[model samples]
Target: MSTPHCLRSSWHAAPANGGRRENGRVNDFDPTAYLPDDLLERIRERAPRHDRENTFPEADLDELRDAGYLAILVPAELGGAGLGLAEASALQQRLAGAAPATALAINMHLVWTGVAKVLSDRGVDALRFVQEGAVAGDVFGFGISEAGNDLVLFGSGTDAAPQADGGYAFTGTKIFTSLAPVWTQLGLHGLDTTSPDGPKMVYAFVPRSEESAGRIVTRDDWDTLGMRGTQSRTTELHCAVAPPERVARRIDPGPNPDPLVFGIFSVFELLLASVYTGIARRALDLAVAAAAKRTSKRTGKPYSQDPDIRWRIAGMALAYDALPPQLDALARDVDGLADHGTRWFSLLSGMKHRAVTAAKTIVDDAVLVAGGSSYFASNELGRLYRDVLAGLFHPSDPESAHSTVATAWLGPLED
Candidate 1:
């Protein structure tokens, strides 16, 4: 599939900007060089099948692992591509353009590695094992979201009780646990109210092993409206334990300035934005292609020549063009350790909000531009329309993003 003209101009313009210096030389990074068109086409071909079956994309994962896509954020010395968040964002956009479910599922793994990269770059080695594990081909799953847990990262519904061995045993349920079947390690957080220091948020990693037997129960209930290949099942933890070495952090509950908090927030929000932006890019391309091919019954000419079709496509392009630069700039800031202080939360959430809303708008317009044929489930635009809705459910949702930005500007409602 050809990329939309507007996207190709900005997306691939920075080919050498996000690579790491290796052996006293900098490696030039181009997302297509890593993803390649053929690999993406294969993933795309499997996407509809996985979505139809509502099953996890196992083949897609194997192919991605073979392509070294799992370790994109790991250092080259650790046998990875040694790319930064900027590069990772670009790669995700490309991958999502082909297979959103595959890209979204993989985004969870990338989030852990991205967080590790963010923290390690700032001299904190608490998550160095994550980077090494990624290079060693161990998939890390994100186990954070909980039903009705609005505190999200600031607090948790799960319990993290301290053990005598300096470990912590987590007991609770984690919803939307992506990579449910394949993750070798799960990164999660829980509340530890029994600690001497009062209620603290405990961040840790639990490996999938005999120790986790009967402790971790993955419920086979991932039926969803779209992005079915993610298989983000609900995980029930019955005293799942994280060894001392796996306990990465402990911070006070409800909004803390800890580096781990910043790292998680930055990587998660930016990566989520990248994925949705990719959906928008794909929708825009489909609309453009549809317009050029379909003839207008009234005018006896291609829809692309119709003023109304042109206007709609132009609006989609205008919205789509704003996201790449924003993603690149914020991702580069994180990589460069450019601190925005408390403003970082607002900025990250706002970007995510804009990307998701714009994606939905673009997809809605694309559906209109593609005409009646796109209404069928078999059409790619139809699939994209459903897939794009998942964006509204991700972190920094419309309500949260608005509240965050409001507080950032209006000073917390005089509370």
Candidate 2:
């Protein structure tokens, strides 16, 4: 497959580096730049339409894909820049700050791609799925959360079994599959339901053409107050699993997961933290901007100067400043872990819990500052509010995650 000429010449994914334009012309990327200001401005412009129309941020995703943002964490050996989890998490934070739903919806690709990159180290074909999607400009989203199964490690899940012919089929129902509407491939997680105790690996690759996975389904009436654009819906699967190459089983820490996986996961959590924080930051930014421009009815001054507003702003700022260092600490711990699991799992759980709470508090402050305007659908604060609220629901719900943490610290939830 030939690479696009536009990508070669007249295009730059980030202004940090001058690159060839889409017309196949070479340019120098500036080392000082992080993201092109034009790109940020463009995302902000599109955010309103996406928030109002309750539509997927197709334009933002397209730009992200074209700029190779989807492949940032992919290893250089596998045709990716090979950024670690810290960088990946920070990028997510920036994206979330601009548009919460858009950022959350797109992150499924990052998580799955990162997982695939790990699996790909075993062989090129194992990870070919990831590279193919990035090159094709298609972002793979997860349909992983099954209410029926209720297994805490993930959302709803079922199982896939190897067929008589050595291929497999996925037969399970999944719920809360955010971004299922636009996903090119489904990172459908399931237990090997065929197993008596469901003790086998069952990640299936189900194409979108399956009739059951029709463009959208509202079964179980999953209506989230926030993240309405996610269209996080439920679906039943009776699809054939394409056998490309055998992937590894994801075991619990007792079996001692690879340090690389543990390390990467530590980074992944921080990324999640950053993403929600970004939503909070954007909410605060909008609220402050709104407050600054509003004239008080009683005084001829900007309402942003009001004492209560100042307090809220201060709270938001504190959250903004505090989360990064916490995340960075976690990243360093994971990076330096000579022994994975049973050694660092407790600390990882603690950081995960702390980060999630800190981010939620930040969003709460931003919402408080915005007042009625934050509730208005026309306002960016409202959209950020919804996105941040939805953030609380995934990567393991707060309650279950809390239980997991306790079990790790004190030993055994069942006990």
Candidate 3:
């Protein structure tokens, strides 16, 4: 297919070296430089097409992989850019501004790579293979969510039967498995009650292979209101095998405050927040542009002159301004190894919930500012409205986030 005019213009202006690192070490790499305007514009142009077709953003993924984004978090010694979480959060926000579903789907891969970086920084080298794998062209997908498992990371519905070969066979159903179409490896956890250790939660990565037929089933049912390009489908694991070397960690069930748990939560929530914050930023910018260009028939002047329009844009900005710094600070803290103890969960979850809520509100206001034009399905704002809704379904949901914050403030309810 021919490139759209909007994308063609960007393609003509793209720089020769947009996303690659000049030196071997990119410790001081700028996040804004991670994705060029041309690349982002291309991703933006493709978003609606994928949304309309209800298909995965394979093109977007290909472009991102070509840009070496999947290896952004791997250490310099491990053949990666070696950038930190703060940098990655910035890049994610930028990516989300162009294509929310693309950003979200890629966030799954980033979460695992980010977790590997977090673990390596904290002296836990178990997930170093994740970084190495990414550099080696392996894509990781998060497969942690399950049906009726409110305990989240602290609990599991999958059964992990130990094998004499030191591997474990996972049997369970994982829902909302993003990157379903192209993930090379899936990071998941299950409970092994029959083990000698007695009921340990086993975390491992299962490689995707056609040779292992009937083990991993990726359902083609991913129809949704927004972020359709994510293709996050239901996955059924019929004794899916993870070799002994792929077993990342095993911890006691029920709130066992392990580093692996902390790393996953911190990276996942912060990166998730970054994506929504980017959405909010894009919505706010669109509102500004629409207001400046649109004219009100009554006044014969641009809507930018209208007091109501001005106030609405200001309100959107007010909500949007607080998130980036908060994300940066918290991400920096994680990179710096600052210890927040139990407060970390509350902070991470609260930030994610707030970003999602704020992005939704900003998108709503943007649609209002754009008038009825944005109401049409072809409008970017309309697509953003749908894409932002998926944030509510992610972990650290509104109710759970509030409960976590409340518990942090008042302590858990008496037994």
Candidate 4:
């Protein structure tokens, strides 16, 4: 499908800042080289429009696809950049700075690709097809989050009824499904209590095709307080079938030690943290710029000279600087196969929780530094204030992270 007319205009209107490559390939495996300042500026220009219109950043997606971003984690042998999680996390942080919603929506796709990369690095070839599919321009969406299933990946309310052919039919509603309008495959999990294995959780990819007629429905109800451009809508799966070939993994439910689970949690939480960290970085930058530009009546000088503004900006910077290095270290650990064991979960969840909380706090301080002008809905800081709230709603929430940490420190509560 072609990009919308509004996005097309914005694309053409953007100055030719030499961001596009002459060969149309991003093989360097470096985000700094791939996502240049000019490209980010173009994306930043389109972000407000998408947010205001409550639509997906189709233009940004088109540009990113052209630049081979979708296949960043795919192996170089598979015609991709062959970058690792550390690099991917850095790239996500940069992307989020330009447009948080766009970066977030695309995070769903990257999660699958990152997991495939993680598994492949660990000598698991199960998800090789995911890398291949992404190289072939197939967009993957995450469909694991379900309403009222606070158990997270430990349990599923969706039914995974086994088929005679060894596949399974999934019937359940998936909430907050990002890239609903354009996803070609959805990675989801459901419980199969009737299975001979005695209650297995089936993780599979359901293809979008004519065969899914009336079986898959994407709702048009994504109006929200912020991150409106994500267009994460509710998806109804009425007996959505996953052929045997698409079935990725099947394991006993309820927190068994599974690599698939670890892959998902680690990549999801780290990448999610990366995005919010980027948002915080952007908020800090904006606050700095605003303070340097706005003159104060009392001092007849830039607010940046004011001790209060300087202190707030310094605080924001201090909070922001700590995240990227932490993200880098953990991502490197995953890439290096450093065995953290169960502590990996606590570390991942804690990093995500801290990143989101810090990002929100930084944005709040940013708006204060930006003054009353940022209170307007059109102001980027105002929009960021809203977007940061969505961080609290993601998995491994504040309560969950704290519980995990507490359990790690003191062990699980008495039965």
Could you report the Cα RMSD, in angstroms, for every candidate shown? 6.8, 9.6, 9.6, 10.0
TM-score of 3: 0.93
lDDT of 1 by residue, 1-415 (tens): 0000111112112213444342111256666778989999999999999988999989989989988999999888778878888888988999999999889999999999999887767667789899999988999999999998888888899999999999999999999999999999999999999978978899999999987999999999999989899999999999999999999999887766677877787899889899999999999999999999999889899999999999999999999999999998899888876656556778889999999999999999999999999989989988998999999888878888888777777766653
Candidate 3 overall lDDT versus native: 0.86
lDDT of 4 by residue, 120-154 (tens): 66666789889999999999999999988887787
Better of 2 and 3 by TM-score: 3
TM-score-sorted candidate list, best first: 1, 3, 4, 2
**What does candidate 1 score on TM?**
0.93
Tens digits of per-residue lDDT for model 2 on 206-258? 55655534433335444566665556667666654635442334433122233
TM-score of each: 0.93, 0.77, 0.93, 0.92
Model 4: CA > 4 A from native: 1-29
After superposition, candidate 1 runs with Cα above 4 Å error: 1-28
Estimate candidate 4's alpha-carbon lDDT, on a 0 to 1 scale: 0.86
Give the Cα lDDT of each candidate: 0.87, 0.57, 0.86, 0.86
